[model samples]
Target: MYLTSKVVIEKEKIKKPRGLQNTLHDDYVKCKEECRKIEEREITEKYIQYLKTELEAAELVVAQESAALQATSIVSSNNQNENKLDQVPSEDSILKSEKETFVQEENLIV
Candidate 1:
């Protein structure tokens, strides 16, 4: 789906062959092969570019979803923490109850 190498595509050397000579069939065949190679490289480069763009869009969607998930988790955790705080007694109330228990224990000892 995407390019594996950091460098996208290697540039092919543009061959500037002179006008085709029709004396021999071999020369014509060679020219056709060269043209085919040029077309192949052109299409290959365009396909690679298309793949790169699709990959970029996919990455962006993944990033956005990940951020949304993290935000939801954070808000859920904060809500849990707030609920815990509400359920727990204050420090001063805990201390006052402990002192009253201590006094009762002391009287019972006496």
Candidate 2:
């Protein structure tokens, strides 16, 4: 019985070192994971800032394009109106032409 008790104590002593090593390994893994989380958070923050800057630049481009489109439309509309005016005779010219036609016709008949 004494020999058996001595063997059991020896076995427990051996198991104690393994348990301590496992505990130390677990602590090391936990610390590594925590550090990784912090690094990931910093990378995420930088990425968010980059995306925000890109978004702002895109918005500025869109605004500039919209302004350009508006100006082009305004100029196109003004040109179209000018072309329409050129195609149509003025009221005063039409009335004067009609009066000359009547006078010539009356002179010819007389």
Candidate 3:
């Protein structure tokens, strides 16, 4: 009876790998590889996001410099305009002053 039981147990163990469960191990390995690929993809996406953020920050810095340059140009133009206005004389006052000088010189000569 003990020998018969041992034979039966070995026969049952032999039947464990029939059709359906044979590929289960292969499928598990494939699934593990797929999970690893997914992890790599997520890491690449995060790196792309970091680069995009850095690009946006660099663009903002360029915009700020452009604005500063524009402001400086405007201030310089305004100063030049003010200086030009100070140097320019009214037309009527210049003619009247010239006429008085001519009359005074003529009277002195006479």
Each prediction's number of clashing residue pairs: 0, 0, 0
**How accurate locally, in lDDT, is each candidate?**
0.85, 0.93, 0.91
lDDT of 2 by residue, 1-110 (tens): 99999999998777555537787798988899999999999999999999999999999999999999999999999999999888878899899999999999999999
Per residue, candidate 3 scores C-alpha lDDT tens digits across 6-85 of 99999878755443466878788889999999999999999999999999999999999999999999999999999998
Q: Can you tell me which runs of candidate 2 are displaced by over 4 Å?
A: 1-8, 11-24, 86-110
- Clashing residue pairs in candidate 2 are none
Candidate 2 or 1, higher TM-score: 2
In the range 1-110, model 1's lDDT, one tens digit per residue, is 35544234332344334453344666778889999999999999999999999999999999999999999999999999999888979899999999999999999999
CA lDDT, candidate 1, residue 76: 97
Better of 1 and 3 by TM-score: 3
Q: What lDDT, from 0 to 1, does candidate 3 have?
A: 0.91
- What is the TM-score (0 to 1) of candidate 2? 0.60
Candidate 3 wrong stretches, greater than 4 Å: 1-24, 86-110
Candidate 3 Cα deviation (angstroms), residue 82: 2.5
Q: What TM-score, computed on C-alpha atoms, does each candidate reach?
A: 0.53, 0.60, 0.54
Ranking by TM-score: 2, 3, 1
